[model samples]
Target: MISRHRKVLREARVVGSERRGTWVYYWVLPPALERLPALLQVPEPAASTSW
Candidate 1:
């Protein structure tokens, strides 16, 4: 018998920066966070509590 573990694969992201009057988000981060800063070069939506 063998036991296995299940891990969820969710690409969670938050707003970072904006440009060209556009709002972008890092919905899917790269292999690491460090890479995100250099990769993501845009702005995210404004934070809101109105779900």
Candidate 2:
């Protein structure tokens, strides 16, 4: 599943998967953390004109 998204993941600076035993873990390098806030940002609501 993840292999299909390699290009996007690489651009996002994700370090790919690590397999230990039966488990797989995905890691993001420090630079990716800086992008998290922008990805999760919420726009402010518009003000109501009616009183």
Candidate 3:
């Protein structure tokens, strides 16, 4: 799972990470930060639902 996440971040070039001992830390890059709000938004649910 960690490898998968790392691969995505590396491919997107949207994050940076550093390893300290047994743990890894990650942070969003400046370019991605600007888009984070849009990326994190969830669309509204449908106006109608059928049971």
Q: How do the predictions measure up, each by TM-score?
A: 0.20, 0.53, 0.56
lDDT per model, in order? Answer: 0.41, 0.76, 0.89
Per-residue lDDT of model 2, residues 17-37, tens digit only: 668999877877777788789
Among these predicted structures, which one has the highest TM-score?
3
Which of the two, 1 or 3, has more TM-score?
A: 3
Candidate 1 displacement at residue 28 in angstroms: 10
Q: Predictions ranked by lDDT, top down?
A: 3, 2, 1
Per-residue lDDT of candidate 1, residues 1-51 (tens digit): 111111122323322223345643223344557666776788788888875
Candidate 1 residue runs with Cα over 4 Å from true position: 1-31, 42-51
TM-score of 2: 0.53
Worst 10 residues of 2 by lDDT: 10-19
**Model 3, residue pairs in steric clash:** none
Q: Per-residue lDDT for 25 in model 2? A: 78
Pairs of colliding residues, candidate 2? none
Per-residue accuracy of model 3 over 1-51 as CA lDDT, tens digit each:
989988799789899888899998888889988998999999998799779
